[model samples]
Target: MGFFNMLLSLAAKGAVILFFLLLLAFLGYCLYIKRIHMKYDHIPGPPRHSFFLGHSPTFLQVMKEGKIIHDKFREWSEEYGPVYRTNVLHFVFICVTCPEATKEILMSPKYPKDKFLYKRLFNLFGQRFLGNGLVTAVDHDLWYKQRRIMDPAFSSLYLRGLMGTFNERAEKLMNKLSDIADSGTEAKMLHLVNCVTLDVIAKIAFGVDLDLLTNKSPFPEAIETCLKGMVFYIRDTLFEFNPKNRPFINEVKEACRLLRTTGARWIQDRKTAMQNGEDVPKDILTQIIKAASKEENMSKEDDEFMLDNFVTFFIAGQETTANQLGFCIMELARHPEILEKAKKEVDDVIGMKQEITYDDLGQLIYLSQVLKEVLRIYPTAPGTSRDVVEDMVIDGIHVPGGCTAFFSSYVTGRMEKFFKDPLTFDPERFHPDAPKPYYCYFPFALGPRSCLGQNFAQMEAKVVMAKLIQRFDFTLLPGETFEVLDTGTLRPKSGVLCSVRHRKYSK
Candidate 1:
């Protein structure tokens, strides 16, 4: 009885000390947030939805409403001006639509990626999704090193060699569409495009044949679940508490695990091949593995880091291009005259050629412009964010340090000041004689941190679109809405449903 009483007394004393320590920390945090709030007092934003939640409630509502977050940002920008602040809890994020501000922020790598967002990708849904890959790496020096090593994989020569693979995968899509067109059935172009892109990336990047065109690969649904979960995780702070979201949360976790596990197996096979002196194809896996092996601080963890790149390249290389192609088809179907013009260009350049050559790509300038216009309006990965570690003045506004600045391509693309009749699908905006959009359009982003696979994606898009336009005439299915869906990447809400018939002139 005496010993038990002594133990209880000691536990009480420890609890009292712990409570006081927490109290001190809470007080310190309050003071810090107060200082941050005062610094941005001049900037205008929506009134706090709650004293405790700030604007987070409204932000969450925007996300949950199946509305693109950037659309909401654009709406708010009209009321609050080009530069407006948003608060989520105590955190202040500045949304910038000003071209000058965007140019300054994106042109340099000094503004590191905001950790609050990027760090979530490092381990989301209690599973490592992107990990510390090139896209999610927060450390500037580390990302730079990885970028340098991976540059060769995306170099002009390397990409040119992959043209054959691009044509091959795109041909599979053409065959599938031909079958659909023969059946007189309306098809979801986005779904078929997704299949082609998935098959292309798997083959070219990893030397793995997914055959998504003929076979229903599990990767697409897995990728969709993972992406949806990530977007959910980003917006919903109380997501875990919702009983309804539990099953979905579990599915996302499993999807992430499946992706990482598949990546690990592929990486191991490559490593084993290298060890056995077997001939391995020159692909992204080979390139990054060489890079990983050369790291000065090589450890098991460093080797595992290559898996990050594997997952990153697979999703990044495929998803954005597929979304872009789907939107391009949707727009062309909507505007038949523009489609006819594009078809003329394709017919003139391709001339009954089944295979698209590198030289053939440049001559398809009109088609290229249409693709560019598509990107301008429907940038799949809409915007990017930066961590302003140091206080900086953007357009005469003093934005303090330790804040996040969001630059949106979607918001900037739609502004009437930048693009006249911004909502209209006009490919002529990218006509050769017209002036270039200065510092305002970046579908694949801009600067030193721009997407490495820009050339690869555009090249692949051109080949697929060239073959598509060369062979088929598309019509959007009736009652199909063209609403943009924001599942991390912006895709057509109705999946670009369309019926197709073989072109009369096609050989």
Candidate 2:
């Protein structure tokens, strides 16, 4: 009885000690958060919702209300001026929309991509997504090495060579759309364009012919699932932990696995072909493999890196261009006058031309302006961020070091100060005679880290869009607003639904 009493006493003492230890840890964490708040308190932002949550609650509210988060950022910019601070829990972001800040942060190599943000992209639902890929690589030397190797694939000569593939893939889309046009069925322009871009990237970048428009494929759905997952996963820190989100999180993991496994199989096939001395096209996959071949002995990490580039190219190479094309079509359909004007230009430039040549793309000047305006209004990629490692004065605002600098083309592009009557979808904003936007317009982003596939993407977009306008007259289906969906990348909420009729001249 005496020994039993002693044991109970000792157990009670241990419980007390554990409680005190936890209390100290919690207190320490609170102090750290307080210090961070104090550090950036001088910066302007909306009032915090709570001591612990910071602006997270407000952000969640915006998401819950089904509004594009960047639009909210633009509103905050209007209220607080161009440079302001926003916090989500302990993470702080300095939003900069002015031209000077944009030029300094993006033009200079001094600011690298934020590791905090990009590293989150390195995985999705516990599956490796873009691990150490060119897009997610935060290391300067590592990214530079990969960039140098891949530059040849995106060079002018290489892109010019890809026009045939671009036209072929886009022609397939035209055929599919023609079928729908005959049936008088409303077509989802976003899905159709997505298939075309997917096919183009598969053929030109990886030397695979998915022919997604002709054949049903899981790739399109998988890409959509992964993109949707990315938005939720990256924004909400506790998203994966929620019991209700488990199903979606599982689907995301499976989608990621599908992409990576497909990449693995394709990569292995290329390796076997190379070993057997079979002829293979020099493509982005070739560059990806070559980027690693220089190493004496390839490691598992190196292999994963190759797959990373595979997934990155497949997603990044296709999604933005597809989204842009969808938006362009939607805008053209809205303004009949603009549609007629653009169609006339396409007729003049590419009339009865089944195969659009590289030279033809350059001659479609008005079409180019329309495409540029689409990007300005709806940059599918939306924004880029940088890690500010040193304190600097941006537009005379003293920003502290160790904060993220966010530059959103979507926010700046819509601001009235940057573009006159920014809400108006004016293609003339990109007219040849108009003065170029100074440091304010960057749909493909700007600087060394700017999209390497910008030219490739635009070339594909022009071909598909010009052909679309040349062959068919489309009208937007009624009852859908011009709402944008932000699923990692921005896309039309209504999928750019349109009814098409074949033009007599083309027939």
Expressed as tens digits, the lDDT of each residue in 123-238 for candidate 2 is 99889999998899999977887787678778898788888888888888989989999998989888888888898899887899888876989898899999989988777777
Winner by TM-score: 2
RMSD of 1: 2.0
Every candidate's CA RMSD:
2.0, 1.7
**In model 2, where do residues sit more than 4 Å from their true spots?**
1-11, 295-298
Task: For candidate 1, write residues 1-507 as lDDT tens digits.
Answer: 999999999999999999999999989878877777788868878787775567778878887687888888888887888788887656789999888888888888898888878898887768889988889998988788788778888888888888899899999999999999999988989999999998888988888998987777779998999899988788767786799988999999999888989989998998899989999988878987787677677677666667888888889889999999999999999998999999999989997889899889989999999999999999998988998889888778888888899888898899888999999999999999999987779988888888999999999999999999998888998998989999889999998889899989634
What is the Cα-based lDDT of residue 213 in candidate 1?
A: 74
Task: Identify the runs in model 1 with alpha carbons over 4 angstroms from their true place.
Answer: 1-28, 241-244, 291-296
Cα lDDT for residue 486, candidate 1: 91
